[model samples]
Target: MKDINLTKEEKADAIEAIKSYFFNEKDEEITDLSASLLLDFILKQIGPLIYNQALKDTHYFMTGQLEDLFSLEKHVQRK
Candidate 1:
């Protein structure tokens, strides 16, 4: 998977959320720059794993749907 790039707006939103979480959960404050750096670090470290898992989940779901569709077709043929 390509680097998980976010739009400018999304980056800003995520940074804000991280800043808020630190304040709310840890009673610590973070600057916008710090939040952004943290976000980038987290994404770089975990994004590939997350992306691969999502692909696997999607493949599994689609395969099940396909199996269900074939089963339905067989049932219809018997009617």
Candidate 2:
């Protein structure tokens, strides 16, 4: 599957949604049941793809930055 891309705001929204699910609904008589059900719903709705893409994109940018820094350091040492 093609990777999912989430903007910063989308990421923040997703986190807030999960937190609300846990906190706001904790007093339900079947709290454990409801929490598990909601968590699964999230996973099904937008969990795996978004999270994996975020991780992969972050790694790609970090690797590029590291390479650039290493090259700059080498050039500086040579000067």
- Each prediction's RMSD over C-alphas, in Å, is 2.9, 9.8
Residue by residue across 1-79, what tens digits does model 1's lDDT show?
A: 5788899999999999999999999999999999999999989997888888999999999999998887766434553
Clashing pairs in 1: none
* Candidate 2 residue pairs in backbone clash: none
lDDT of 2 by residue, 21-69 (tens): 5577764243444545555676667777787898999999999999888
Each model's lDDT? 0.92, 0.66
Summed backbone clashes in each candidate are 0, 0
The parts of candidate 1 lying over 4 Å away from their true place are 74-79
Q: Each model's TM-score, in the order given?
A: 0.86, 0.40
